[model samples]
Target: MKRENLLVLLAGICTGLAALALTMLGNPANMGFCIACFERDIAGAVGLHSAAKVQYVRPEIIGLVLGSAVTALIAGEWKARSGSSPALRFVLGAFAMIGALAFLGCPLRMVIRLGGGDLNAVVGLIGFALGIFIGTRFVRRGFTLQRSYPARRTDGAVLPIIMLGLLVLFVAAPAIFRLSTEGPGSKHAPFFLALAIALVIGALAQRSRLCMVGGLRDTMMFGDAHLLWGFAAIFVTVLVGNLILHKFSLGFGAQPVAHSSHLWNLLGMTLCGWACVLLGGCPLRQLILAGEGNGDCAVTVLGMIVGAALAHNFALAGNPDSVNEAGELVVGGISMAGKIAVLLGLAVVLAVSVFNSRLGAKKNG
Candidate 1:
């Protein structure tokens, strides 16, 4: 096996093990790492939204950015660049978050949910692939977001510096943050420990260039399974770990932090998958790129944070299935508003894809 592929496989193994460890140590079930969920929690903690139950500064996020930044610097791979449709990228980022929240997780978490045997994630996986397939069609037709230019080192360091401040606030000035007393936000592994694990995962991901969206996109576009190997390793590792730990529950209902709204699950992920393709990376990949001094990706990350805030504020996020006081299964899903938002997201992304494609530009010219 090539060294790069092996590194990716190792990264996947470590990621899966980290997720399992964090869960055992008190993070939400099948939620050892979720870029969307953690970012949403960070938004709430910083008063971006009023979601009381999901407010906290997740150290894993802080660690991921910092870890990647540090690793890039050490590897001499850090370079500052920006200016490729920043405004559009930000909007796309927002819509991506909106879609992911509508489905209750990002692509990474979707895979993790699958490892834990959630059948709903299987539905999400199908939709995600379909979305990627649609995006690839545009790519084959010469879809392009244009080129980015070189930037100042400080511009690239902005996100890392911000993450450092957040870490300080998380560790030193916790009183200023609105910590969740209950719900998923309240459930977490130890702060330093989670941070430490995430730092390692970030370093590994940076080295291996691990990305779930890239895995599917590359396979479709170039018949390359190089990136997919990492996710495959992750799935196998998590599946074994869950089974050994008795955390594997194969069913559609009663899963933690998930809904049985199969249609929304499919559509939401479809939107997320499509938007990420246009953005040129998944949420996790965006974070890693931002850390490596891509100012445009940093903007996208900021947009995702705000998008998460807006989701909760506007009731666009999905609700999980729950048992009611009457001892009956109460189905949980997105509201009409959320449904509209997802459909709107799809329309907006489609428009972006068309306008950005070379064929569309040529026809207009």
Candidate 2:
């Protein structure tokens, strides 16, 4: 393999190891790092969710954005710009988190879930791929965001600094933030250890542009599995790590903070998959891209924070025991309504994009 490919492979291994170690240390199984879940916890810390059992200011997320920023600054990759369909990207981010929560994990969690023997993750992965395929179709049809212009350095760096501030606060005031009483937040690696792992993963992910959603999308659309190779490495490494840590629990009868509803696992990830496609990357990808001064992604991250708070305030978030009042099993409930809303919203946005693109083409002609 080429040197660049080799770097990506190593990076993927580190990603898996970091996640596995987090789980082995006490995080929910296969849930070492979930973008949506962590954001939800953060939301609760700031009073977004009153769910006392699931509240904490997560430092990993803060490290992700700030770590990427540091990489970009050192590499001279930071460039502030916006106007890439900002509102649309925001909507996509919100929906992506919603979908991820429904499945109880992000793409990273999906693979880790698989490693830990959660068969439902297989369905979620498939659904995620299908969602990406749908988004790819739109891309083929000329789906594109608007161009972005350069902005001030502060405009780009502000969010990262803010994230860093949050991290400092977390380290100083874990009690005020409200660590989980009985959930994933309660079970954690030591503060410095978790921070170190997150920092390493964040730096590597920043360099590799490794996104779980983007990996499969690249393969299906461009016939390039370079990104997928990273994931493959992650899977193998994490599986081995799980074995060594005795975290390998075969057959998922009742996994921690996970549900057994296969259909929801599939559908939720489908929505998340599609949203990631539309937004141009997954949650992790958005953070990395934002660090590189992609203002559009920055806006999307803001949308996710907002959406997470909304999810909990509105009783949309699930508990650590995998019990969501709005789960797929709840017919004629809020979850169903949320699903319908997401589908219709996406359809409307897509139709508008198509119509606007055609009109612009005609005018130019």
Candidate 3:
């Protein structure tokens, strides 16, 4: 195999092993590596959301940022840059969170779910693929967030600093930052182990550019299956690992941390997939870029944090059986508020895709 293929394969193996380790050691089932879910929990930990059951500053998340930063710096790949439309990316980040929470996972987690034999994630995977496909249409039409520019080195180190601060807070047992008393927030692998695994996974991912959205998009658009190899590795490794460990169980019902609303799973991920493609990267990519000093990506990360807080406050998130703010929006076993949120997201994504497109700029010129 070529060197690039080897690196991506290594990255995928690292992702699967890390995810499986976290789960086996006590992280939530089918959720050893969900950026959105972890962010929502972090929001709760910081009192951004008062959802007490989900409050905890995840060490893995902090590790991801710092680890990526260290790796990029070591590899001489670190670059501080920004300039893409910050506000639009922020809103898109929020909507992306809304959609992920509705689906109960992000693209990575969707794959993880599939590896664990949750068929519902199959529905979600379809939706996510469709969303990326739609976003490709926008890409073909010249959708652009504009160019990024160089920035100070300090900008690149911000995420690592913040992550270190959070770690310090955790150590000091600060009352200011809420630590969970129970629920998913309370369950965790050994902190040091989780951190180490995240560091390894983040470093590898940074180097390999492991992105599910890019993987699918490239395959669909360019017939290039290079990115797919990483995903395939992740799936195959996790599937085999789960089977060997007796963690594999086929079916939609009784899947841990997952709901049975198949359509919502599909639609929610669709919104997420479409938004990620238009944003120029997935949530994982955003985090990695932020570590390398991309201010725009950092802004998008902040948007996701805020979106997580808002999702819980507005009763837009879902649990094992139902979504919050249950009412007329519920249809096809999915909430109506959820439905409208997705529709609005689609409109915003479409609007951005068209209006900010290079085609529009050319027309004006």
Candidate 4:
């Protein structure tokens, strides 16, 4: 195997193991790492919303950014760049978050849920692939967000510095942050331990350029499975680990942090997949890129944070399935507001894709 492919596979293995270990240590089931969920928690912690149950700054996020920054610097890969449709990217980022929250997990978490045998995630995967397929059509028609330019090092450093400050706030002044007394926010592995594991994974991801969206995107657009290998490795590793640990349960209902609304699961991830394609990366990729001094990605990350705040404030996030008073399953799903948001997001993304395409440009010209 090529060295780069091998590195990505290794990164996948490490990520799988890290997720399992974090769950065993204290993180939520099948939620050892979720960029969207963690960011939502961070937003709540910072008082961006009034979600009392999901408020707390996650250390994994802090570690992921810092780890990528340090790794990029060491590898001489860090460079400050920005200016490719910043405003549009921000809107894309927001919609992307909304979709992920509507589905209740990012692509990475979707894979993790699959590993844990959640049939609901299978529906999500189908939706995500369909979205990617749609996005690829736009790409084939010459969709372009235009070019970015180099900037001062300080511009790139801003995100890393902010991540550092968040770390400080998490560690030095925990009292000031609105920590969750219950729910996903309250569940976590040890702070330093989660940070340390995430740092290692971040370094590996940075070196390997691992991304879930890139995996499928490359396969459809270029017929390359190079990036997909990493996710494959992650799935195999997690599947094996879950089985051995007896954490694997195959079913459509009663999964942790997930709802059984198949239609929304499909549509929500479709929105996420399409938005990430236009943004040129997934949420995880955005964070890694931000760490590598991409100012545009940093803005996208901030937009995601804000989107998380909006999700809870507007009651647009999905709810997990629950057992009701009669001891029967109550299928949880997003509200009508969430449904409208996803549809609107799809319309907006479609518009962006069309206007940014060569065909659209020719018509305008």
Off by over 4 Å in 3: 322-334, 358-365
Which segments of candidate 2 are over 4 A away from where they belong? 172-176, 318-365
What does candidate 1's lDDT look like per residue over 84-182, in tens digits? 899999999999999999889999999999999999999999999998999988977778777899999888888889999999877788999999999
Candidate 3 lDDT over residue span 207-264, tens digit each: 9988888899998889987888888888888888899999999987757777778878
Kindly report which residue stretches of model 4 are placed more than 4 angstroms away from their true locations once superposed: 359-365
Global lDDT of each candidate: 0.92, 0.75, 0.84, 0.93
Q: Write the per-residue lDDT of candidate 2 for residues 1-365, one digit (tens) a residue.
A: 97667877988898888888787676666778887888777877877667776677776787688778888778887788777788877877777777777777788888888877777778888889988898777666666665678988777766687777777777677566656777566666676777777877888888888888778888889998888878888888888888887877865446666766666677778888887887778888888888778778888988887777776665654333333466524221236655564465457545645764565455556
Between candidates 1 and 3, which one is better according to TM-score? Answer: 1
Pairs that clash in candidate 1? none
Error (Å) of candidate 2 at residue 145 is 1.5
Better of 2 and 4 by TM-score: 4
360 in model 3: Cα distance from truth in Å?
5.4
How much is the lDDT of residue 12 in candidate 1?
93
Deviation of model 1 at 44, angstroms: 0.3
- What's the TM-score of every candidate structure? 0.98, 0.90, 0.94, 0.98
